[model samples]
Every structure is written in C-alpha cells, then in structure tokens.
Target: MARPSEGAARGKPRKIVLVTGGGGGIGRAAAQALGTGGRHVVITDIDASAACETRRLVTASGGTADIVEANLEIAEETANVVEHAAAKGMLAGVVHCAAVFPQRTFARATITDFDQVMGLNFRAAFLLAKAAVPVMEVKGGALVLLTSGAVRLEGADTPFQRPFALYGASKAALDRWALGVAPELRDRGIALHTLTPGAFVETPGTRRIDRRAIPSLPIVPARQVGEAIAWLARNPRMSLAGRRLDATAFGHTWGPG
Candidate 1:
C-alpha cells in the first residue's frame, strides 16, 4: 500500500472523505483513521450527538472533520451531503458504513421490519452512491461499502438473534449493486468496492445483545478494519473494484505490527 503524505494539502485544499454512518463503531474508527491520514473527513449520521462526538474524536486526532446529521434513506439529506462534500473541491473518497441488521427471523419479521432493514442496508447504499458519484468525478475517487462476515460464515454461533437471512440477503444484494456500478463509475474515473469485516464487535450497535451470549469468535480488532479501509481509500487499485474483501485477507495484506 502507498503511504499518504503526513499533512493536509496546501493550495487546492486536502482531499475530502465523506463517511456515511460515521457516528459509531467501525464508522467512527474509519473516520478517525482517515483524518489522521491527512484527509478532510466528514462524519455524518442519523444521530446528531454521535456525529458531533465523532467529529471531536477526529479533530482530537489532529485531522480536520465536520459533522452532518442526516437520515441517509432520505434523498434530500443525501443530496445535501454530496453538495457539502463537493464544495470542498476534490472529494477523493467515500466510505459507506451505514447498515441495519435487526435480528428477527422471517417468521417473526414484519413487512415494515423487513422494509426498514432493506431500506437502510441496501437502498440507502444505492442512494448514497448516487450522491457520491458526481463529486468523485472531479478527478477519481474510491468507494468502500462496509459489509459483514456473517453473510459468508452463516453457521457461526452468536446469539445476537441471527438476522442471518436478512443480513445475508442484503449483503449479497449490496455486493451485486457494487459490481453493477463499478463499470459505470470506472468510466468516470472512480473505483468502487466492498469491504467485509467479519468478527464479533462490541459496539453500541451490537451492545443491544446479551453480553453473556456474545460468542467467543476469533475476532479481528475493529481498529484493524478501520486501518485497512483507510489504506484502501488512498491506494486507488482498479483490481479492487467489484470485489468483496474480508478482514483476514486485508489483515494479511496491510495489518500493522
């Protein structure tokens, strides 16, 4: 992987990174990681307070950042996010970390529940990418879609109420969407891909589960996934487009000492 310059850019300003779902867990980690990597990071979330806190964390890390409160499923908010990032000049990358994994089996899941899950997990991704594409066209940029390992390693015992079917279906659909959009984005000098960080994470998002039942899965640290994402954002590799990379593969390629 390439080593990014230590400080922000001079005249034209630093490359800007728009991270959706930046208020929590991997999103928060990725935002902070990118900020430290000399990029101007924008942290947006449905939660205003969380976004502000994340912005603080990024700034504390010696990187410039801003917080935008947005419900990504809404088109207007999505447009505003893109417009704000474009105003920054070179929107070099976007890390889409927003998702919903409500653990209800099909039998227990209502149509409303399924719609909400699909809306946030898959539909929102499509809309976010739509918003991001124009800014990325300024030169070229990277797109990173966050996915879970649960989709592939389905049998893992984590009593977090396996929304296994929903999670897996949404993920597979998201992957296909990335692949479909990659060629179009590539024509516009953009690179799009997905990253799957499969492991048990103890974030506010997952904390809703029973602690005792949280399986002792061989987990990759959240920070490692954040670092890999930061590296990938700046790396600009065409081979990554339309591909889904797991934590193990990414760790083997770019893990720290």
Candidate 2:
C-alpha cells in the first residue's frame, strides 16, 4: 500500500488528515503524530486557542497543520470542518475524537444532557462521514472513530461510575453505526474502523472526573492511541475495514519507531 507521504515524494501534494477534538488529549496527540509523519493535518476543535497550540506543536516539530474551530454539535458546523480539510489537499484520513462526557448520573441527567453528549459524540461522526466520504472517494482514505471500553462495561463498573451511562450509550451507538456503515464504505475504497485506547487514559477530560472511582487497569498513554491512528491513516487497506482495533495491541506490534 502507498503511504500518505509517498505522494509528496512523487511531486504530488501532501495528503491531509482531519483530527477532531484536536485541542488536547488523544486528538492533539494524533495531530502531532500524523503531521510528523508528513501528512498535512487539519485540526478542528471548539477551542481556538487550544487548537492553535496543537498547530504550533505540529509545526515546531517540522510538520504542517491548520486549525478549524468548530462546535461539532451543530450538524452544519460538523460538515463544514470536513469541507475545510478537503479544501486544503487530498483528504486522506479522519480521526473522530471529539466527544463530551458530562459527569451526571443517569438519574440526574436531563434530555438536554443526553442531546449534548449524543450530539457531539455520535451525530458529529455521522455528519462528518456524510460530507467527507464523497471527497475521499476520489482517492481512497480512512476514517477512524474513537470508541471507549465503557461501551461494553456496565456503568456501575466503569471508572466514571453512573455518570458514564450516557457516554457509554453514545459510544455503543457509534460503534454499531460504524460497523453497519463500514461495508459500503469499504466497497467505495474508503476504510472505516473503530478504535479504542484499550485502557483508561488520563486525558484532560477524564481528569475532571472523580479519580476514586477508577479501577486498577493500566493507564494507556495518549501517544499510543495517536500512533495507532496515524498507522491506520497511513495504511488505509480494504482488509482493515470494519474492524475494531486496540491501540495498546498496535503499539506492542507495528507502532512507529
């Protein structure tokens, strides 16, 4: 398979990869990793300052990046981010990491809370895919949806406890949706897959939650998840479509040097 950067070597424009939630956490890490690997990374986040910081980090490390500030909960805004990336260069990959995890127990959660979580976490992925697939179809690419282990674990057993109910539901919905939609995208030469960190990651978002509720599982570094995403983006193959991959497993096996 031809890597994303090989185009640049062949005198073609550098391919672009879109990373949502790029202000921090796994999103920031993925942006840095992909950019360092020679892909022009387009980072979208609600926070302009934080996204700019990510852009700085990418450029400082001899990579290229652009920031598109967006509130992904809005369907139009979500699609607009993809449009912005496609305008930059060949839209080669997307890492959907934008999500909200409000620490509200199910009993105390309101319809508004549900809407907010599901809107950004689930709906944004749908909207981005709708907009990006056609642009990417001209040249095959990859779409990686970041999922959580909370989707499988019981809410009470999760690190976030009862508050994880809505978050888990949102991820479960995304996982099922991605699985159902992957086959058709694969036929279109677009590889779609869901990825998990495979363990708790102490990101800025997770830091806000109660640490006492967390279990004894090993903490996976954000960079591991980032590298796995970059790996998937660089190798968008038909054989890899529709699968659920673990970042830790990839890190141990075929990770970046």
C-alpha TM-scores of all predictions: 0.88, 0.93
Top candidate (TM-score): 2
Q: Candidate 1: lDDT of 23?
A: 92
Q: Indicate which candidate wins on lDDT.
A: 2
> Which runs of model 2 end up more than 4 angstroms from their true locations?
1-6, 153-160, 251-257
Count residue pairs with overlapping backbones in model 1: 0
Candidate 2 weakest lDDT stretch, 10 residues: 1-10
Candidate 1 lDDT score at position 14: 65
Tens digits of lDDT, candidate 1, 52-143 = 99888888777778888888878888889878886875788888888887777768988887777778888888887788887677778888
C-alpha lDDT values of all predictions: 0.77, 0.87
Which residues of candidate 1, in runs, are more than 4 Å off?
Answer: 1-9, 153-162, 210-214, 254-257
What does candidate 2's lDDT look like per residue over 12-125, in tens digits?
A: 877999999999999999998998888989999999999999999988877888899999988889888999999887899988999998888757999999999999899999
